[model samples]
Target: MDADLPPLTEALVQDVIYAWCSSAKHEITVPNCGAVWGPEADVVSVTRARLGHEFEIKVSRSDWLSELRQIRGDRRCAKWYRAHTLTNAKEEAKKTAGLAAKGSNCCGLVPPSYFWLVTAPGIVRDDELPAYAGLMEVVPYRHGIHQAHGYRVTETRPAPRLHRVKLLDNQLMAMARGVTLRYWQQRRKAA
Candidate 1:
């Protein structure tokens, strides 16, 4: 860590991700509970066209590895998770769907159309990311003089579209509800 840089926390990374998504013209940017994916996203953003983007924030390398393990399943053979190709991963998921139903940790469902992993600088390398996932890093500002006090989120690798379907009305509603609930919860906490 740079001496001038503050340590990255999950909340800080999440705030950076939310700001990044909002600046990208996401119509709806919310923290937590998209409810469209099998797992709750750290941050979820929706474009005006209703395309969904899910961001999973990790402050440490261990957390990142753990996430991959949970999604890819620990028992699967090397070819499955190591394949990296979306088609290959999907085929493996299909093969393991029964295993998932049998209480395995693997997630058989397709993720949001766009999936990203957000982390602090040096925590995840671009080459380490799975083919289907993108990488975003929160690093000290690299541009201009007399900079702001906070870090900026930069997309080191663009995530490929994993699913084609636009978010359905109910799914959008669920996200909206989550945002509303979070708002009140924060307000209450501040009180």
Candidate 2:
């Protein structure tokens, strides 16, 4: 019944993210771009030239804080950051409040060439992001009988080619799974 429509959830945030990626310029976007048991971001895009983009979508404050805390407390994430850095990953290694950006850095896996924070419109302040990171807003609405999706790019930049190729290769080998499972994988991988 129409009255029983699902409530807005992180799934919606992921859907909005996927839509944005599909329409994004000159990049191939994939949702759940990690293995069935790996840390995955809500969205990952790879440019034709092989640049990697990572996006974190927070539908709730809890989700946002959880991501932040994971970045700050996870030793394995720090280890991955160190490992990727030795390979000369393209992204910069920033130390934010003693938490390394690359240790975020994926919060668990390899950091993308570019990392972005996306949230529902009016949810975050631009000043909260690192200078290199971008912020985006996703707004979904229903117009009478038709539903349309829209997004606002408050700030953004291009992805990195070499890193993107690596992301695509990694996702290709990942076992297919549902979004919920993949999301939990990210949480678990962070710990």
Candidate 3:
């Protein structure tokens, strides 16, 4: 690392992602919600049940490997689909449940939903990444000195499903709490 260079921070990567996604019209405005769900992911943005995206920030290869281990080990993330049991569809629900409960890599859900790996620009090329992974590049500058912008996303997968994520436990509560807390906090500050 050069003395003039700045270390890439997770926050910077996330900020750029937030801006980029919003600019591109993604429904998820918040970042890092998936962290509380299972293993602490860098960012997981969900737009109701229609779409979901996961962002993994990696400043270095080691950082990338480490965070990946957490997700890999967290068996809870293996299942992202749910069973839909509508009236007159008991048989379908049963079958969906059976498939959902199946082991990982079961095609339980339609994928290509962008799992973004935001890293230092040019750190990892797009061709080098997994087919399912979309790459977002960031450049970190000194705190409050250099701003992160012009981020690029390449080879991104579009995640579309009736159920983007299956609520594992109280993750929904946490998200709600975050929304309420932020609302009040901002209101109080303005008040």
Best by lDDT: 1
Writing each residue's lDDT as its tens digit, candidate 1 over 1-191 gives 57777788877777777667666788987776746554466788889877778887889889877766755675655324433434353454344444555776643443367878888777776667787888887778756432234778777888887756566555677788898898899899999
- Shift of residue 172 alpha carbon in model 2, Å: 4.5
lDDT string, candidate 2, 69-112, tens digits: 55445466742453344235444222221243333333323345
TM-score of 1: 0.73
lDDT of 3 at 183: 84
Which ten-residue region of model 3 has the weakest summed lDDT?
A: 79-88
TM-score of 3: 0.52
- Top candidate on TM-score is 1
How does candidate 3 score on lDDT?
0.50
Worst 10 residues of 1 by lDDT: 78-87
Error of 1 at 126 (Å): 4.4
RMSD of 1: 6.8
Runs in model 2 lying further than 4 Å from the true structure: 1-7, 25-27, 36-38, 73-110, 140-191
